[model samples]
Target: MKCINNEFLSADTYKLLKLAKAKAKDINYKYAWVHKGMVYMKKNDDSSKIIIRIEDDPTCMSSNLKFLSLNVNSYTAHTASFELLVTETKPHIISVVETWLNPEISVSLNDYSAIRRDRGFTDESGRYVRGGGVLCFIHKSLKSKVLFISESNHINHPEFIIADVTLSTGSHMLISCIYRRPQGDLLDKFFLEFGKLYPHYNNVLIMGDLNCNLLKSDRASNHLKSFIDDSALFCVPFGSTFHTLETDSWLDVIILVSKDKLVNFSKSKPPFIDGHDFLICEYKLGSQNHYNKVVKFRDFRNCNHQALSQTLNERLRLTDIDPEMIDLDELVYFFLYQVTTSLNIYAPMSERKICRPKCPWITRELKLEFHERDALYKRYKRTGCQNLFSLYKIKRKELKIKLMKVRNDYLKSFLENESNGSNIWTKLRRVGIVKSKQSSPLDHFDADQLNKFYANILKKHLSCSRDFILNLPHLYSKKVNFEFNWSKIDIVDVTKNLQLTLQKSSGKNPDRLDLKWLKDHIPQVSLFLNLIFNRSLETGSFPEAWKSTKVMILGSNRKLKSLANIVLPQIIIDGNLIPYVNTTKHLGVHLSANLSWDFHISQFLRRLFTEEDPEIRRSDRLAAKNNISFKMPNFATTTYEHSFVVTAIRLWKDLPPEIVNVLSLETFKVKLFDFLISNE
Candidate 1:
């Protein structure tokens, strides 16, 4: 028998070997192989019921049986080359043999020579030189009775072989053996194919040299993202596994299915090969003998076993500690009580949701009150004040003095005014001002009031001084820090001089009066003047001196009179006229000429006619007396007499359509006023 490529051994295997040696006398075995040809044995263990066998080869029957018997039985069995072939009679024995060899060598052992007896390998030039194929076997297990074989035929494509282990537990396992190309687009094709293949398996355990890093590749990441979008399977949380000593990257994984079943499984460190690590999983198969049995296996030895167990324990602990199962309302109430007690305040009612009374405000209030209470309690405790009332009085007196300073500072502006007095009555009045209220006389004159009389005396003196300074124009101006010297001349005289200077500069013409300039130089004064003039006009009480002068002086300046006639007439009429009259007719002819022709025609007609009917002879005589042209009518046949026809025809021919429309509209009151006034 030959076994090849035995490279590594585990520490537990050594212990097992030692145990085998100690039991060697019972087995009566002479020797056993440790690894590929490194054999050791005890001469006395030939009769041993169990034996230790370790080898890398799968085709050797002796080695395979020894490996199986060690796991199935306790006693050591030493055999040099024992072979017991059984037909149907010893089926159990045959079953055991089959179990051992089936897992170990089914995929690896091939009778290719039988199929190609005359074939030989080809030389470099393609002539036949040698004819053989590479073969390898893989075993994957996920759950009970879930096992599979992956075989590489001719060192190329790996084919998954289904086993006939029908599980009573209704569990199915998936196994995929991937032998990737060295470099190509083959990875994309492999993943595309795997996505289609994955849905068929219930429990998948894929293992092999996939030659692909799932983490570093974008396509792999995207595929994993898609896989996780469904919550059925979860990836294990081992950081990295393979390529232990290589600097580039590690963890070419053997992915598992029904991942929640193996949730606590993890990878072992210090790879099986020095440069390639493998995962160890501790999975719960099912309940056995009324207790859970965790099956742990690792592809690597000499790795941390405790980590795997710890991972399992943590997962169990998390499941046990999940807080979602607790009653949340009770938890919230308890937390509320905790916060309220810490704050030394009552918790807010559950119905109130704005700013909760149980918030940081309560905490801050408690902190402040505690500081105050601590000081008072210390003082009362030191003073030996027996009654609560007496202790409170003491604390209140102390607090009152401290708080009085704060109140004084708050009212310092009102108190510091020279006109005000710092006394009970004045303080009450000051408080009223702060509260925005009126003062009372009893607040000053009460006999029991502290400093009441003095406060009243001071207030009276302040009132008199205020009035005196107000009456004194110089002092009033001084108070406002104005440069005007009121004592040098009467304030009225100074104002009159300023007005006269303005009027002279304005040249008795409203058009030349720079209202903007007046506003800039003396905004308050100008505003006051305008207000007075407007109010007088509105009340029909405008002083005849100003009004007459305004009209006459404005009429003297053609530009001023034109502006006043057009703009100011409307302003005055809109402001004061209960039943307005035509002011434009009152305007001089030069002002009337500036009016629109509609005003000229309407004014002329109103002035010319007063009654509905007129004597033709009288109209004709009047037209002749006014030096206006007239035409006499020959009314021998009709009662209607046509007189003043020449004047009427002349006026009708001169009137424009705009003038006609203006005369026709009854609501055109301003137009009527302008026309009548201009005609007058």
Candidate 2:
């Protein structure tokens, strides 16, 4: 170590700082120790002096931490792929470099919150640099804030985005995403800024595509090598990240230096296929925020539906234990017991931790195709064969098409069959058509607070509802159709309605009323449910479990943070003016203003307004595109043959393009029959 003076440090035009409890700490001045994001190295340099910072003895305050670093050339263009990465993969912090974003361009992900620094800022020459930027996508559940952003006047200066994220144990971790151009002398510039920021935060993780490959013997590589001399920080020993036909190099790196131990870690292959293979490190940071609810789920894929049906049919012999032979309640109870017992034997519930969003659309075939494409790419990269590269590109394009088709098919099937507004919105939200804002940090309101606030307004109505027996008799006295009445609805009708209800999982359910289980065993449960419902109505009593039919009080709420800036004039009723508050509750719905209520219910109102009588024959299957004229299966001797064949061909032609291209005659026949039966 040289004398702690200006001349020693001024030897380089740029510099960086680092972490170490070394003998060089005995120095004065704020910029006393040289920062360590860069280095200088020669081939013959002494190997013993190169202080490796792997921290063989682990020390850490965090319980669970995972980071994914990628050099996404442009995040905006690849957002759909990136969304899959963030949601499917469990990463606490996602660091992306080379985002190629600008101020006017907006990027939003459903569950992950983004902090981006675009390279639009002017350099020393007063011209904006075209294509380098850095960003971090922190999971929404974590408490985080932007700590610093690097804005150097030099055009070739390294770009950085720094964030301090708080773990569940309330320990803060400084995350930095850095990106540097492959230019000259910028190593010093990068480390100079990084050096100044490193000392303040103890728990630090630096990730980026810094363009200086440490494996190479060059001036920039030497600079990085010298930077690693400090004992506190270490770059992960990752193999060649950036891959091409003729070259493979470690241009991307994850450099971490923290006081806490992070020894228990693992890496994963990134979901997306790109030139730069992403670096994923799953770290045991600290205590994890236990938010994911452990739910009991039966693997229906393994369950034999036919066996379940046969068992139920054999067990419920109506003649032996018929309604005439036994009491209604006893018969119902017996049927329920038999059904539940059969289900228990067939599809028993097993506890599973939800690690990712449910993507049932990602069928086994699609997943296999995805893996095969990845394999092709990896093989092409390894062998550098032109034919393999061509095949990889073809597979990649085909896979993209299939992915889109599968997702669209999932949505189509859902929307066509399910009409429940809440379930529809839930699906849309999950699929990301609806924007999901991060849960507000400032929200302190709870159920009790809301209840107390509403109680005050309710006090004025206390005098209006004292006599319930006299007022409640009108509903019982009025005559109603026997089929539609609550006292004696048909079991068939109840079962039909239940079929339309979306399947939902339940937790802490004492009665074990999982909607999925009920739906799966619907045929067996219909008679039992009908009997119970009729019994309840006849007895003028409600089952406690069924009382939960009321809408959940904590209905989905839109993020209120965006409404903070909205200020409206006071409402004047007669001569008195009523002051406006931040949130106004109308019929249990939180809204910003009176006019917002209009916007809130506008969809419903629009439907009502535009409700002209639709045509009885709404479907134009015959008019759809590529309406092929079908040969009558060599039996076009009657009107039935002409109408049926033509209609079937039209429908087949109108199917999704990929589906039409690959559909077999047998599948088309089966689909056509089903369509005819459904329409009938």
Candidate 3:
């Protein structure tokens, strides 16, 4: 084999080569090469590049019960590094202090959802502002709610935000992120509000940059100590020894409800340049599952498609029978059974492990530099040598530069791709925005009230009156009659409709039957369905089993809780005023009373309105106004309404006044669907 030549290799590769050479000498070989974690050698010398690619298994240190807190003086400066650590570590929760960020600034975390409280300003022009800010990021998988402290209105407290976290252990905990300035005026107010709020929450954690050195016997430290003692809180005193900066004074603190509550706690030095050390704390939430269940999916790419097709055709041909002998329902069952059995024999599904890429920017070169910096950091910590610290800082800076280059390049390429064709707006939505059915986190005290609220709304919307229908004009009747399709229901049409519906199936049915079965026996299944549907239409009734329906509740904003009080529990559906549900999917569309769509729109508008770049928002408005045609990529075509902007625009543009203002909900739905189909 021909081989390329190289004069030198990377330091890591050189080290690996030396080790391989030493091993080869011991094994009575002239040369060796390490490939796929195994050594290979040739008797004859051959010059080569000696390039080896070693793929590291990116570790994701996620847990159902993990919390992290850090005080980076200027988070914007080190956000990339922080995000790198966060993505790899996958902490359940993170609290950041001294973010020095403004409301207009966007901080994106792919795996975590963040809420921020920037330092309040006093000027009308909004030009003058303070530097300190607090931001919190909770893993997207966790159930968390952003809370606004009511007392902030009455008293001037420091920048802080409270979050209600539902632990995997089934217990709810409240976490507060506080950033107190050294000025000390708001310090007193912070304590007062915290003391008042403490009574309301059972388990609590308050962490931030307090700017008070506990080691000093001074009044500020002593006062904080007294407050902690009185409030029945425990302070993790690593603060006294773990210096936050080169100043060699500890100012950061992690306060908990009690000392015994913390199952695991440790402070570690981060490789990145930062003021405060990273603190990881795990609370013992009794009986909570910390690890997520590993979900594997079948690798269908390797399926025997030719064999499956042959088996499916054979099975379908064998099942042919006289139409009169077997009814449509029986034919469907038989066809499905055959197709399903064929699939099992030829293309059975299996579970396989999945490996997700954690950090795309972590190249081998950057990894080596990071490891070097980390080693220097450890040596510095152990020996307390200023030289090691300096060397660590140099490597850290170089690593940061490399990280920035990789991030910027990736972002540049991403923006270019996203901007190509119709992806500009679509990919922007994917950045940090999520559209979901909004539901408020409800306490047991208010659960009944919230359920009743949804039950009332659904009842009001779904219920119809005979009198109201009778009052409609004869012209309306003519419109409805004209709109109806009078085409005769036949075997061919029924078969075609069934085929189309099966193609659209999302594979979420309770029955194990899949699309392959229906596709394989379309002729038989279609004939069967046509007969069944025709009979049902002629009889003016559907089977009771087919007539059954499901209801989904949308979550609303907490501020709308008072609206629930107006809804009495008189309305009953499914034998309950309101059925118990977390979230429900109906006809493939997720629904909730909070109707997260409304909340999503509000959030979208909030960001849109506050956006510093007027051009971006202006373009969005223009796009909406012009009713621009947004062609979705093939992959994205499955679900196009992933963002509030896209969804709101589509709904608004399609539903004209005639359709939207229709008095009858049934009519509105019919017209709305027609409009959507025509547009599509």
lDDT of candidate 1 at residue 226, scale 0 to 100:
60
Our tally of clashes for model 2 stands at 27
Kindly list the per-residue Cα lDDT of model 3 for residues 1-680, writing each as its tens digit: 21222444433344455655665566555556655443345545653424323232111222225678887777889888788777655567788987878767788787578888877563667563647788898876567887664234211347788878866445677888887667454367667666666887768888887777787877877888998998899987665424543556567777889887777777765423454677777765555333333453434566776677666666666336664565445655665677667666655667644333245556787888788889999899779999999999998988888888997887678777653444454444434233224234442325566555544544443322334322322212111211222334887777666667764524334345555544655664454456556644543333322322322333234423433554422324323444443231111212333323211112222232243553234223433344443322222222232243344444555466888567785887898889888887
TM-score, one value per model: 0.22, 0.33, 0.34
Top candidate on TM-score is 3
Task: Give the range where candidate 2 is weakest over 10 consecutive residues by summed lDDT.
Answer: 595-604
Residue 244 local lDDT, model 1: 39
Question: Model 3 — which ten-residue stretch has the worst lDDT?
Answer: 475-484
Error of 3 at 286 (Å): 12
Q: What is the lDDT of residue 358 in candidate 3?
A: 42
- Sorting all predicted structures by TM-score, with the top scorer first, yields 3, 2, 1
- On the 0 to 100 scale, the lDDT of residue 646 in model 1 is 33
124-237: candidate 2 lDDT, tens digit per residue: 797665688888888775778986787764557788877787765666777778888878345665576667767777567888888887779787777776786662776777
Q: What value of lDDT does candidate 3 attain over all alpha carbons? A: 0.58
Task: Give the least accurate 10-residue stretch of model 1, judged by summed lDDT.
Answer: 66-75
